[model samples]
Structures are given as C-alpha cells and as structure tokens.
Target chain A: MIAHAIFFYTFSIIAVVSAIMVTASKNTVHSVFFLILDFISISCLFIMIGAEFLGMIMLIVYVGAVAVLFLFVVMMLNVAQQKNQWFAGQQSSRHIPVGLIISTLIFFEIIIVIGGWKYKPEIFDINNSISQASISNTHSLGQILYTDYIHVFQISGMILLVAMVGAIVLTFRQRSGVKRQSYIKQISRERAEGVEVLEVQSNKGVKLDD
Target chain B: MEYLSAVFQEVYKILFLLVPVLVSVAMIVWLDRRVWAFVQKRQGPNVVGPFGLLQSLADALKYIFKEIIIPSSSNKVIFILAPIVTMTLALIAWAVIPFSATQVLADINVGILYLFAVSSLGVYGIIMGGWASNSKYPFLGAIRSAAQMVSYEVSIGVIIINVLLCVGSLNLNDIVIAQKNMWFVIPLFPMFVIFFISALAETNRPPFDLPEAEAELVAGYQTEYSGMMYAMFWLGEYANILLMCAMGAILFLGGWMSPIDVYPFTLVPGAIWLILKILLLFILFALVKAIVPRYRYDQLMRLGWKVFLPLSLTWVVLTASYLFYFNLLPVN
Candidate 1:
C-alpha cells in the first residue's frame, strides 16, 4: 500500500506538471514533447492503478501515434519560430479575467462532483459491480466490451472509418502536370503498338511526324 | 528489514538481466554485420578478436572516447533526451518479455500490449531527434519515420489482435504455453508474414528504412548525432530488433519451447530454444537487408495503407470467424 501510494503520487505529479508544460511551453515542438510526457506519466499512473490494458492502449494511441502526428505537423509547418503572444498582446488583458472566471467555475464544478462522489460512493455502481477476482483485466474488459457494449463498440469503429474516409477526401489532391507510373498501361503494352513491318521502306518519307 | 531485502533482491535481478542484455546488444551488432558481409561474399571484422568477437567492445570503447558534438542550432536538452528515451523504452519493453515460463522481470497481465505500446513509442526518438536537430534533412527523415511507424502500427495492431484471439490471454507466457500444441505461424501464416514485414518497417530496417535512406536523407535523424550519442541510437535500434524477434518467437514460434516436444529437443532448456529462435530470426533479418532493395517512398506507402491494411483486416475477420465456427474460441 505504501509503495502504491508513493508511485501514484510521483506519476500524478509528473503528469500534472507535464500537462501544464504542454500548454505553457514557448516552442510548439516543446509543447508536443510535453504532451507526450504527460501521456506517458498518466499511463504510468493507470498501470500503477491496475488498469494495465487501458494504460498501454493510452500510451500506444496517444503518446506513440497521436503526439507524433502533432510533432510531424509542427515540424512541417515550421511553427516553432512563432513568438507566443498569449501574454504579449495588449488586448489579451481584457480576456484574462474572463478566462480566470471560467476556469475557476470549472474547477469548483469538479470539486463539487468529487465531493459528492466521496460522500455517496454507491452512486457509481447502484446496479452492477463488474470487476471480479477470477478474470484478468484484459479478460473482463473483453467480456464487457464485446458483449454488453457490442453495439457501442461497433458504432465507434464505424465512426473511425467514416472519419478516415472524410479526412482522405478532404486532403487528397490530383495534379495535372505530374507524371505517375501507370502499372496497367505498362503491363498491357504490346509490340504491335509501336513496331511495324513497313517501317524502313523510306526512312525520311515514313511520316514519322504523324 | 524484509522490505529492504526484497527491494535489494529486485535491484539485483534487474542488474543481472540488464548486463547480459547490454552485452547481447554488442554481439547482435557484430553478428548483423558479419551476416550481411557473408551474404555479399566478403569477410566482416576479422581482426578484432580472432573472427571479430571483440569488434563490438572495440567499437564501444571508441564511442566512449569520442567527443559528443551537440549542434549549436539544435535544442540541446531534447537532442540529448531523445536518445535516452529511445534506449530506455527499448530496455523497458523487455521487462515484460518472457524468456521462459518463469524468467521475466515483470510478469504483467498485459504483457503483449505493453510490448506493443513500447514498440509504437519507438518513433518518438526519431521524431525528437529530427526536430531537435533543426536541420532540413533530419526533419524530413523524422517526418517520414513518424508516418511510416504510425501506418505500420495499425496493421501490426490488427495482426496482434488476431494472435490474441487464438491464445485468449495477453500474457507472454500464456501465449507461448498455448502454442505447445502447434505454433501460431502454421495456422496464421499470412498474419505471421504481415507481422514480420510490419516489424521490419517499424524498426526502420532495410527496404523500408526510408528515414535513414543514405541516398536521400543522409543518415536521417542521426545526421547530426556524433560519438556516444550516435552509438546509443545504434544500440537502441538493435535492441528493438532483438525485441521484435523475441516478440515473433513468443507470439508465433512457441517462444522458449523446443520445436519438437520429444526426445533430444525437450532435453534442452527453454531459454536455449528461445535464443536459437532469436538468432535465426536475426539471420533472416540480415539476409533481407542484404538481398532486398530499398522501396520507393510512394510504393512503401502504397504497401502499408493499400495492401497491408486490407489484407490484415481481412485476416482478422477470417480468424475470428474460424475460431467461432470451430468452437475453438477461448472462453474467458
């Protein structure tokens, strides 16, 4: 229990600090790196808490794939040179108070929800307690994911498929001047298309231009 | 007192495992070079220690003595951190990899996923290196690597899911034990091929090593690195390759188990079999590097997205249906 508490605190602190750095960093590239760190630390926390499958998935999907995508775009666009203007702009002062108020409200709302949950823990599972001693985390997750939430799982997959198609359609382009290899045309080429028996009859008068 | 002893024991185990792993990295590097050289009809590193046994140690010493040059324009912190991240991730992934039924650093329940996750994160080192270098070529190389790894990861994920369907457990030991009857490669031959190919691409090995394509990118993300820093990348990369080979062994080749369960084969310990399998896989990797030509960029993308994606996805469906039909599906 002591070891668990120590690990939880360490990872949570790292996660929080890195999450802050993700937004607070000046360089966009640095921000992306911080984002990755945040994901990693949070995943570490998840693993420590026994949701090993979820932790690994979070690391794979978010830190590994998504954050790398963010880094790729940031490097490609060369946005690291952009001076952070969050505090520099004179007009930013007007919106600062508004931001503060909104953030505070959200913070209180979270605290209230946590407090209520702490007082009435049964609100979370009034009906079913899914976790069991016999099955491993992966096994139980698979059971619930593929059985009771099967429709939701399928729908989420369809959503991803649609999003993929939509992204392809949006970004895909065709250029007229570019020369591309046509495998079909190359494979289908025939000797009759270019060679002729009467070709040398009159080299100059063979109407080569035609 | 008991807690202190347990902690000490854990540390001892870690050190015990890590030293051999580090040494194996050296051997693998030497072996890879020798194998590649042999394929091309040449002798490789014959002078180091009577047939190049000490070549890796010599190289390590040279790297240690060399100067680490941090490019002035590069982000100093990240440039250093990148290689460390790569090496750390590579080493940590082994914590979950089972050498035998009993030998492992951590016998986690989600061992396969943990491996998958670590392998996927391998791209960050390249990306971070490329971006931190602040050079055009390295940046380009980093982007290519990032995209390549991400694309291959999708197909790899699908392939692993197909394997898990057969084993019914995510534990590496369980996967290997389940294969006692028959290796997964025999039944899931196509998926095995896809997984191997994907692993090659994931590790940025030859034919798919566009990130470091010397003809174009000029060493890719390692263009700016020097001395020990560069050596670290080399070590990390070979470590990753070995890890992938181990992964292949455990997932499909019955891991540490002998090929035939009878007689002489069974007399040998499981760890020896695992080592043999890894060596065989490494030789195959080297052979591919020597024999296969580098793929064109567009063709690589076409293979990953158009060809592999659909093929692996179809196999996943087929595997599931077959399992369900035969009532062979593992009930949790």
Candidate 2:
C-alpha cells in the first residue's frame, strides 16, 4: 500500500506538471512532447492502479498514435518559431475572462464528479460485476465491453470509421493529365499488336510514324 | 529487511535478463556483418578477434572513446534524451518476452499489449532526434520513419489479433502453451507472412529502411549524433530488430517449443529452443537485408496500406470465422 501510494503520487505529480507544460511551453514541439509525457504518466498511473488493459490501450492510442500525429503536424507546419501570444497580445486580451470562466466551470465539474464518487460509493457498486477479482483485468473488461456495452462499443467504432472515411474524402483530390500505372493493361499486352508481318517491313520502317 | 531483499532479488533478475541481452546485441551485430559479407564473398571483420568475434566490442570501445559532438544549433536536451529513450524503450519490451515457460520478467495479463505499446512508442526517439537536430535529412528521415512505422503497425495489430483468436490469451507463456498441439505458423501462414514483413518494416530493416537510405538521408536521424550517442542509436536499432525476431518467434514459431516432441529434442531446455528459434529468425532477417533491394518511399507506403492492411484485415475475419465454426476458440 505504501509503495502504491508513493508511485501514484509520483505519476500524478508528473502528469499534472506535464499537463501544465503542454500549454506553458514556448515551442509548439515542446508542448507536444509535454503532452505526450502527460499521457504517459497518466497511463502509468492507470497501470499502477490495476487497470493494466486500459493503461496499455491508453498508451497505444494517445501517446503512440494521437501524440505522434500531433508532432507530425507541428513539425510539418514549422510553428516552433512562432512566438506564443497567449499573454502579451493586447488584441486577444478580451477573451481571457471568458476563457477563465469556462476553465473554472470545467474544473469545478471535474471536482464535483470526483467528490460525488467519493461521497456516494454505491454508484460504483451498482456495476461491480465488472471488477470481479476471480478473472484477469483483460477478461473482465472484455466480458463487459462485449456484452453489457456491445452496442455502444460497436457504435463508437463505426463512428471512428465514418470519421476516417470523411477525412479521406475531404483531402482526396484527382489531378488531370497524371499518368497512372494500369497493372492489368501493362501485364496483358501482347507482342502481336506491336509487331506486324508485312512484305516491305524493312523499307516501311522509315515510315513507321505513318 | 524483507522488502530490501525483495528489491535486491528483482534487481538481480533484471540484470540476469539484461546483461545477456546486451551481450547478444553485440553478437547479433557481428553476425549481421558476417552474413552480409558471406553474401558478397568477403571476410567481414575477421581481424579483431577469432573470426572477428570481438569486432563489435572494439567498435563499442572506439565509440566510448570518441567525442560526442552536439550540434550548436540543435535542441540540446531532446537531442540527448532521444537516444536514451530509444535504447531504454527497446530494452524494456524484453521484460515480457518469455524465454521459457518460467523465464519471464512480468507475467502480466496484458503482456502482449504492453509489448505493442512499448514498441509503438519507439518512433518518438527518431522523431525527437531528427526534429531536435534541426537538419533537413534527419527531419525527413524521421517523418518517413514515423509514417512507415505507424502504417505498418496497423497490419501488425490485425495480424496479432489472428494469433490472439487462436490462443485466446495475451500472456506470452499462455501463447506458447496453447501452441503445444501445432504452431500458429501452419494455420495462420498468411498472417504470419504479413506479420514478418510488417516486423521488418517496423524495425526499419531493408527493403523498408527508407529512413536511413544512405544514398539519400545520410544516416537518417543519427546523422547529427556522434560517439556514444550514435552507438546508442545503433544498439537500440539492433536490439529492436532482435526484439522483432523474438516477437516473430513467439507469435508464429511457437516460441520456445522444440520442433520435435521426441526424447532428444525434449532433453534440451526450452530457453535453448527459444534462442535457437530467435537466431533462425535473425538469420532470415540478415538474409533479407542482403538479398532484397530497398523500397522507394511511395512503394513502401503503398505496400503497407493498399496490400498488407486489407489482406491482414481479411485474414482476421477469416480466422475468427474458422475458429468459431470449428469451436476451436479457446474459452477463458
């Protein structure tokens, strides 16, 4: 229990600091790196808390895929040189109070959710079948995910599929006069079409263009 | 006192696993060079020791003694952190690799997922190093590598799912045990091929080594690194390759299981069987390096996306249906 607490605190602190650094860092690339660090630390916390399946998936999805895409975009855009104007821009100052209000509201919402869970523990007990100790984490999770929440799980997957198709549709383009390889046509070509048996073939070679 | 002893025991086990792995990395490097040389009819690295056994060792010493030149314009912190991250991540995935039924570090329920997650994170090292160097070639190499790895990982995931359907478990030991009757390579031959090819692409081996195409990218992300730093990248790369080979062995070749169940084969320990399997796969990897030509970037992307992805996905469906039809799926 002591070791768990020590690790929990360490990971949480790192996650929190890195979360702050995600926005506080000057360079956009650094911000993305910090974002990745935040994801990793949070995943570490998840793994430490015995939700190993979720933790590993979280690492795979967030740190591996999402953060990599974020870095790719940041690197491609060459935005690291741009000075952050969050604090200094007079023109953007008007939005600060609005941002502060929204952030505080969201913050309180998280606090209330955590506090509710803490105060009313029966809310979790209602679905306690999912956390049976007899089975492994992967088994239990799979059981619940495939059975109790099958529709929702599949619907979310379909939504992701639709989003991917939409993104491809949005970006895809066809350019004119582009020569594309037709594998079938190239492979099916016969020599008979190019080679003709003519009496004056040697002399007619000079008039091949005709 | 008990806690201290437990900690010491864990450390001892880690060292037991890691020291051999590091030594094997050196040996594998030498083997790779020799394989390449044998293909070209030359005696590769034979002067350092007996049959050039200490060539990699001498290279390590030279790297240790060389100067580490950090480019003045580079992002110093990330540049240094990149190779460390690479080497560390490469090594840590070995924690879950089962040499035998009893010889694994963490026999976690989600061991396969942990390996996948760790291996997926390996791209960050190259990306970070390339971007940190602030050079065009390294940056280009990093982007290519990032794209290549990510593209190949999808097919690898689908291929792994085919295996998981057969075993119905994620634990590496469980995977091996489930293969007692027959190896996965026999039934899931197509998926195995896709997995092997994707592993090659994932580890950035030739014909998929567009990231470090010497004629173009000039050592890729390692262009700016020098001394021990560059050596770390080299070590991490070979380690990653070995890890991929081990993964291939575990997933398709029945891991540490002997080829024959007879008395002679059974007399040999499981660890030896596993090592021999890994060495066999590594030799294949080296042979592919020598024989195959490098792929163009677009061709690599096309192969990963257009060909392997759909094929692996189809195989997953087919495997699931076949298992379901025959009631062969392992029930928890």
> Can you tell me which runs of candidate 1 are displaced by over 4 Å?
A79-81, A84-87, A90-109, A126-128, A187-210
Going through the candidates in order, state the TM-score of chain A alone for each one. 0.77, 0.82
- Candidate 1 residue pairs that clash: none
Model 2 lDDT per residue over B1-332, tens place: 98889999999999999999999999999999999999989888899989999999999999999999999999999999999999999999999999888889988888889889999999999999999998999999999999999999989988988989999889999999988989989989988888889999999999999999999999899899999999999999999999999999999998989987889899899989999989999999999999999998887999999999999988889989999999988996
Q: Could you tell me how far off, in angstroms, the CA of residue A103 lies in candidate 2 after the best superposition?
A: 1.9
Error of 2 at B31 (Å): 0.8
User: Could you give candidate 1's per-residue lDDT for residues B180-297 as a string of tens digits?
Assistant: 9999999999989999999899999998999999999999999999999999999999999999999999899999999999999898988899999999988989999999999988
Alpha-carbon runs more than 4 Å astray in model 2: A84-88, A94-98, A185-210
- Residue B120 in model 2: shift from native, Å? 0.3
TM for chain B in all models?
0.98, 0.99
